[model samples]
Target: MNFFQFFVWGSWLISLGGYMGNQLGFSGLQIGSVYSTMGIASVFMPGLLGIVADRWVNAERVFALAHFIAAGALIAAAGMTDFASFYTYMLVHSLFYMPTLALSNSVCYNVLTRRNFDVVKTFPPIRVWGTVGFIVAMWAVDLLGWTKSANQLYLAAGAGLFLGCYAFTVPPSPPYLDETRKKSLMSSLGLDAFVLFRKKNIALFFVFSLLLGAALQITNAFGGPFLDDFKTKYPDSFGVKHPNLLLSISQISETLFILLIPFFLTRFGIRNVILFSIVAWVLRFALFGLGNPDDRLYLLILSMIIYGMAFDFFNISGSLYVEKMAEPTIRSSAQGLFMIMTNGFGAIIGSYGSGWVVDHFTDSGGVRDWPNIWFTFAGYALALAVLFLLVFRDRRIEDIKR
Candidate 1:
């Protein structure tokens, strides 16, 4: 299940930019529409599903159903020959897929608690292996030459099919059928988590979450194609020839740095670690703005290296902070709320906003005005960093009363 959750993402994710731009003959905005489709699902499904899992159904069953739907959606997506059709199927697919990211966690938590496992101590080490699984899936596509082809969709579909069936066999997450059960499914879903927006710190965190998310796909949606373009502009370019392999470096770095997240959050605390993330994000975009496949290889490599710190620092550490801070009754709900902010709303902002900016700058030749676009992104990160420092006070937990 851990493998498929990321494996499905890997298929379309890393290579979609090149496929959309070069093969489907799309402009950047059109490609953005496809990417934006994910935001639509992330918003609705996660909370709704979490509520269902908490109240009426088993989290594992919900996870299986979601994967089944996602598999069918992905397979349908495979048959799409045009952007609009592809986007529609992807939209449906993500509605199911996004929730599973959270549901899988729910299932893991339920099983761990039932078995008396020390989740805080044991889960992180086991979870680190999921990053390994993600890296392996990424390399599978690269080595199999699935990087440039539509077959990547099928690779994901196959995994989804397998997991969908396997989900039922896993340990059951019987619905909250206990004496503690409260209001019907509606309230259990923590639809009330939305009230959290009224809180100053949460509201601030979510605002920055969206702005930072804008940077998330700026690279994923453009990086591979950008490197591959050098292949054409410089036919002798070795970088383009091996772009997938080079891009894989980011995942390798991603896997390694994620292991350091628990430590970073514990030692430096949330504010400084998050500040590090913002600084790293600025450099990430700046490096890509200047990097090339040829002699500037080190810059590209450095960009991928920082991707570890930039992405894992903000996302992983942010989630841990929520886990540490929220009241236990609504603790998991708080994490769900975070996803709605980052993956759901933030994704929508990133996908559409970045596309518009990219479209605004590009010429008739389809060449990206990369430096301007990237610097513009850097400014966004910097602005968010400033806002975070000014407004969100992270008082030492013990000093603040409930």
Candidate 2:
């Protein structure tokens, strides 16, 4: 369940921008707009479908249905030649696909809890396999020479279809259908988590999460195309020849960095750990701005390494922070709110905003000033870091316990 779940996404997520920009003649805005579909779907679909899984059907079934529909959408997207058709299909794909991310976890949690397993101790190992699946899918797509082709979408579709069927084989996760319990749509959707905004510090933390999330989206949307573009300057470069493989280093780095998060959180506290992430984001973009396929290839590799820190620190640490701060009853809802801010609103901002920045640096003949574009991103991240430092306050985990 974990492996094939991410396999479907990894097949296309990193490479789709390159495919759109290079092969389909999509402009930066178009590329960003396409990437934003994930954000658009994430804003509401997870909660909406979660309600379905909670009230009407088993989570595994909803997970399966979502994958089946997403697979069809990916196949449809693969056949589209125009932006409108492509975006429409991809949006359909996103609407179904994004929900499965949460549904997969729900299914896992339900099964694990029923089996009397410690989710906190056991789930990470299971989750790591998903990362392995992602890395494998990335390498498979790149090695198959499908990085800039529609074949990546087909590959994703194939994985999705397989996972959709495989979902039914899992233990059943039925809805909590008690006669005494009634939930309004808003409550079921976790909208009550919005009340957390009354606390200024928590509110500021969420705001910074949104800002840093934009940096993340920028990297995901453009990192591959940026490396692939090096073909013009250094056609023999390893990065140009296999951009997806080189970018996979970031995921490898992610697995390693995740091991250090416990120490970072214990040693520095949540606020400082997240601060490190914002600073890492600064370095991540600045290095990309300065590095190339030639002598500075190490910089690119370093950027990829730093990505682990940039990504894991903010997401994992912020989630821990949310867990610490929220009341037990609202904890799950608070987590959902955190995702809405980061993956939903933040994704929309980053995708569309970075598209404009990319277009700004591109000339009429379609030559993009890659260095300047990266530098601009770095500047944005730097500003976010500085602002986050000034505005957000932290309570140490020990203090929170008291």
Candidate 3:
């Protein structure tokens, strides 16, 4: 279930920018607008669907239905030629697809907890397979020469249909609402999870999450396009010929880092783990700024390698922290809140902000100043890292374990 859930995403998430820019000739803001659909959807869908799963419907059923609908949207998106039509289809697709992220985690946690498994220890291994599935999908797209083509959307649609069918076979996870108990309006509407903001620690964590989340989409929205830009600059370069494959190194590194989460979280605790993630983000962007495809190929590979740490340390570790802190009844809602901060608002900022930077650096000749744009992004990440270290209080691992 987790495998194909992410496989569908991987089919296009990393390469879509290149596809739109190189093939369809989308402008920076237009591409960012398209990617921002994920942000807009994340802001509402996860919390809304979580409410249904918690109070009304089975989570597995909701997950399946979302994917089934998303499959049709992907098929529609594949046929779109104009930006407006493509954006509309992608927006619909994202609305249905984003919630499934939290839903999948909720389903896995429920199943694992029901079986008396330790989530901190068990969930990382299971989630690693999702990264593996993502890597496989990336390779498939690149190897088949579909990286800049609509065929990638078709591939995603196929995966979505498969997962939609497979979700029904997963362990049943029904609503956990206690019908006899009187519920407040907030609880009934699933907004009760917002109460966590009243706690100083949780509030600070979420604020930092929003900051970090802004960094998340910068790479995904532009990395492939950045690499593909080399095609024109160095037409004979390996990076240009296989930009998708080159970018797959990031996912490959992600798989390794996902496995290390149990060790990192247990040893360093969430505060330090997240701090390390911020530092890694600094390196990730700086490397991109400094490196090129042919002569500085090692730097590009290094950037890809660091992406694993930057992404896994903050995202997966933060999810685990939320799992530890949230009550069982509202666990899904808490996850939705986390997604809202990171992927929702944060992604929106990163998408629009980075798009503006790209446009700002482009000359009248249509060529972009890639190095300066990357440096600007790196500077943004560095500022966040410094602010996070100064403002957030660190919690010890032993204390959290209790």
Evaluated with TM-score, which candidate comes out highest? 3
- Candidate 2 lDDT score relative to the true structure: 0.82
Give lDDT for model 1.
0.75
Candidates in order have lDDT scores of: 0.75, 0.82, 0.90
105-151, model 2: which lDDT tens digit per residue? 66776787679875544555576677788889999999999999999
RMSD of each: 2.5, 2.5, 1.1
> Which prediction has the highest lDDT against the true structure?
3
lDDT: worst 10-residue window of model 2: 327-336
Q: Could you tell me which 10 consecutive residues in candidate 1 have the lowest summed lDDT?
A: 393-402
How do these models rank on lDDT, best leading?
3, 2, 1
Model 3 / residue 210 / CA error / Å = 1.0
Clashes of each: 1, 0, 0
Which scores better on lDDT, 2 or 3? 3
> Higher lDDT: candidate 1 or 2?
2
lDDT of 3 by residue, 141-249 (tens): 9999999999999999999999999999999998886853126678766686898888777788899888899899988889988988887668888788888788889
Can you give the TM-score per candidate against the true fold? 0.92, 0.91, 0.98
Candidate 1 per-residue lDDT, tens place, 169-227, comes to 99998765554548535365456556666767767777777667767777888787778
